[model samples]
Target: MATKEFKLPDVGEGVAEGELVNWLVSPGDTVTEDQPVAEVETDKALVEVPSPYDGTVKELLAEEGEMVPVGDVIITFEVGEEAPEGGSEEAEAGTEAEAEAESESEAAPAEESAESAESAESAESAAPAPGSGRVFAPPSARRLARELGVDIGAVQGSGQSGRITEADVREHAESGGGEASESAGPKDVEVGTRPSATTKRGEESASAAAGGAEEGGAAPSGVEAAGRDRTLAAPATRRVAEEEGVDVDDVPTDELREGEAFVDEAQVRQYADAVKRAKAAEAEAATEAEPSGAEPSAAESGAESGAAAESGAEPETIPYRGVRRTIGEQMQQSKYTAPHVTHHDTATIDDLVETRTELKERAAERDVKLTYLPFVLKAVVAALKEHRHLNSELREDDDEIVLKSEYNVGIAVATDAGLMVPVVDDVDQKGLLEIAAEVNDLASRARDRSLSREEMQGGTFTVTNFGAVGGEYATPIINYPETAILGLGAIEKRPAVKEVDDGGFMDDDGPSEQVVPAHTLPLSLSIDHRVVDGADAARFTNRVIELLENPQLLLLE
Candidate 1:
C-alpha cells in the first residue's frame, strides 16, 4: 500500500488557513472518498473536511487547535497501489501537475518546488534541494530566515508545492545550505543567512555536475541565478512591493532555492534599502572626495530609512491570524476603497413607544420576543424602495451601479471570535414577525459562531445598532460592495417640541408647539459618497424617520 498525504484543501470564500478544531478519524481507522475526516474552523465558520480517496488512516499530521495554512499536509493515509476507480480525474490532474513541476525543476535546479502534495515526495530525491517548490511558507519560516540571515531564495522548498517550513530553514542553515546554496553561484551562496548581496561575489560550485552543465567547463553559475521570469510571493507582499516601487521580478538575494526565489515583504523592503544605499553611496563618493561635516554620511542616511536599524520594546504578543486577521484585512479594504460620509438626525418616536408597548402584549401571546430592530428593518426597506441607490452595489469592475430590487439587510453582530454580519433576505416579502424571528435566529447563531457563509452573504445594505452598547451618533464604515449602512443610536426620553391643541391632539389643528419629554431615536446613515449625493441620503433618512414616528402607518403596507 502506498502512502497518500492529504494537504488541507482551500475551503472556499478565499480562506487561506484554518484552525483544526477536531479530527474525526484516528490512525488505523478506515475512511473513504467524501467521508468527513476532520472539522476545520476557518476565518468564516466551522467546516468538515472530507477525504478525497479511499484509504485506511495511517497518521494524523495535525493536532487539535493547531493552525494549518492552505496546501500544508495535515494527514496521511494508506491507500491502494493505484488511484481508486471513481477518482481517475483527480489522479490524472495530480500526474499532470507533477509532470509540469518536473519540467520546471529540470530547467532550473535552484528553484526546486512541488506543485502538489504528491510531487513533494514523488522521487524528488533526484532534484531535491533545500527549499520549497511553492515557497508558500508560514510567517514563522520567513522570520526564521531573516533571523538566520539566510537567503530564502537559495533554500529549496520541501513542502506541498515545495513549501519551506521553519524546520527546513533550520536544517538548511545547519547543513551549511546543502547542495542548492553551494550551486547557487558567486553571490553569497553559502546560505545560513548572508546579508548584503555582494558578500560572496565569486564562489565556486561544489560538484563538477553543475560545472559540466556550463559549456565553459568551470564558469560561475551566477549567469542564471535569476529565475526564468517566475517568482513566488503572497498577494499582500506583491501589493506592498508594488506600492513601494519595487519590481517583484527583479528583487535579488544571495541564495537560491530549487533554482527559484520566494519573495516576501521583508525581502522586498531589504532590496529597496540595498538599492537606495548603493546608489546614494555611489553618488556621495563621486561628488565628495572627503567627509563633509554639513550633512550626515550616506551609509548613515540609508540606515535611518531602513527599518532594520530600529529597535522596539517587547510586549505581550498575540498571534494575529485566523478570523481577527481576516476581519482586519476586510475592514482595511473597505476603508481604503470607499470615501464615507455620515448624516445624523433624530426622530421623536413617542408613537413608536406606544405601538411597541401595545405590540409587546400581542407578541408575548404569540411567544415572540419582539424588539425595535424588526420595525427598523421594515422601515429601512420601505425607505430603500423610494431611494433605490441606497440599496445598491458599486460594481467598479463593470463600471456600473447595480440597484438591487431585493432588500436583503445584514445585521452586524459582535461575537467573541469576531464581528459577524448575518443577512436577512427578502425583507420586503417577509412580515415584521417573520423578519424578527429570522433576525433573532441569525443573531443567536452568529454569536455562537454557527452561521454558515451563505447566511452571512448577499446583503444589499447593512444595519448596525451601536446603541445597544451605549453610543450615540457614530459614523460607521460601509459594509463594502453595498453602498450604504444604517446606524441606530440609543433610544432615550429627551425634551422635544410637541405640537398640541386645546383638544390635546399632536401635529393637528392649532399648529402650536409645546416642550415635553418624548422618546427619540437617533439615526446615523453612512453612505459611499462616490455613488450617492448628500441630498439623497437626507431624503432616505427623513423617510425612515417619518415611518418610525408614525408606527401605525406600517400596517398600511
Candidate 2:
C-alpha cells in the first residue's frame, strides 16, 4: 500500500481559496477516479472536486465548513496494489513508519491503562452494554440524548446501520421519549422551580433598561428583542415582506406554533397592508411635528431636506466578495470610463405583429414558439452589421478601437435576487426562431442561477426589455465594456396612416376611409459617446427602427 495526497484545484477566475461545503467520502471508504469527493463553494459558484486517483480514503485533512487555500492537501488516499509509484516505495514507507511511531509514542502516556481494582472499575464503567458495542452518532444526536436523559446504549439507532442521527432523535422524541419536546417540558418545569441568581439579576437589569429607554424618549428595549424575531426568516421571505411593506413581528405566530410549515400568502398580504398603514401614520406624525414658519429659501430648504433624508435613510452595506461584487466593480468601471448618450424612437409594428402570429403557428409544429425578443434580437444584429461601430470596443491604453466580427448579444433578465445578463453567441448566424429558443433557454438558466461564467462573458451589446413591466421609455445604462444598450418599451395599439386605392383619400362611397390601428413599440438606445457620436447613434437607432417596422428586413444578413 502507498499514500497519495489530493490537493484542492483552482475552480474560479483567480480564486485563491474555497470553503469546503461538504465531503462525500469518509475514512476507509473506497472511491474511483473521477468520482466527486467533495463540494467547495467559491465566490463564484459551488464546484465539485473529483478524486484524482482510485483508492481507499485514508484521511480528510480539512473539515466541512473550513476554508482551504488552493494547492493545499485536502484529502489522502491509500493506494491499492495496482497503483503506480514514481520513486522508491520502501524509503517512503520507512519515513511514514517513523513519523507514525513518533506520534503514537507521544500519545501513549495520555491514554495509558491499568489492571488494578480501581482501574478495572473505571474500565467497566467506560465499557459498552452486554450486547451493544461502540455506536457511531452525530454530535447533534448525542446532544439530544443528553438533554432528554435518554441512555444511548438503551436506544436502538435506526440510521444507516445503527448510526444515531438528528432525525433518529427527533423521531424518538415524537414517539414521546426521544428528546426535544419531552426534554423541553421537563427542563422548563425544573427551571421554574429553581431560578438562578444570575438569571434574576439579568431580568432585573432588562426591566430597568426598558424603563430607562422609555423615559429617554427612545424605543423600548423590548422592541429590540422583538425585532430579533424577524431575523429568523429566510432572506427571500424578508425581501418579499419589505417590498410589500410588511412588518414581520406583527404577523401572527400561531401557524408557526402549530407547525403549519410555511407562511401563507394571504397572511403576508395582510401584514403588508398593516405595515403600509403604520408607515402612513408615522409619516403623518412627522408632518404634524413640523414647526409653523415662513417658507425657507429653495436652496436652504433643499439642503435641509437632503440632510433630513440622509439622516432618516439606512445605509445598505453589502460585502464585496461574490459575483454581485464583481458585477458592481465592472459596472462602475464602465460607467465612469465611458461617456454615454441616449436616443429614443417609436415603430409601428402592425405588419410585424401579423407576421409573428403567422410564424408562431408554424413554429409550434417544430416545438418552438416565436417570441418578439427573437425578432428584436435579429433586428438588432442586422442593424449592428450595418453600423459596425456599435459592435466595436475601445482600448484605453493604446487609444485604439477594435471592431468585432462576431455578434454576441446579452439579454438582461430580471430575477428575484438581482439582474443577470446571459449572452447569446453568434446571433447573426441564427434564425429568428432559433434565437427565440436560445433566448428562452438562456433566460431560464439565468433565473435559476445555473449559467456558467463563459455564458455570461464576451457580450458585445445588451438589450433590456422594460416592456414587460409596462414602461414606455427609459434611459438605460450601458452594460460596462459593451458600447451600447437598447431598451424596449411596452407595445400599444394606436391610430396610424394607411394607403387607399386609386390614390384617393376617401372610399368610392364618399365616406372617410378607416383602418385598424397599429401596434407601436418604443425603443431607447444608449450609446457610449466616446466610441460613437450623436449622429452615429441616431443613424443606428433609425436603422434598428427600420428593421423593426419592416420585419422582412430583419431576416437579412
The best candidate by TM-score is: 1
Per-candidate clash tally: 29, 2
lDDT of 2 by residue, 1-557 (tens): 88888677665657788767556567887765444466565555444565656688999999866779977888889887776456434433443343222222111000001112123223323533323354445333443454444455566677666776545766666676533452211011010012334323232333332211122333322322123222123223444445554444444332231122223334444444333333344444555676787455675556456546645766554335444555677778877889878899888887888898889888889877567888888888888988888888988798899888999999888643357788999998888778877877677555434455678789999998877666778988888777899998877786766554644455565545457587888889999999988888888888888887898876555
Tens-place lDDT per residue, model 1, 74-135, is 88888887645445446534533442232222111111111211232222223334333234
- C-alpha lDDT of candidate 2 relative to the true structure: 0.60
In candidate 2, which residue ranges exceed 4 Å CA deviation? 1-5, 19-32, 41-45, 53-68, 74-319, 415-418, 448-452, 469-471, 492-518
Residue 138 displacement (Å), model 1: 31
- In order, candidate lDDTs are 0.65, 0.60
Model 1: how large is the Cα RMSD against the reference?
20.8
RMSD of each: 20.8, 18.7
Per-residue error at 114 for model 1, in Å? 35
Candidate 2 residue 302 Cα shift, in angstroms, is 47
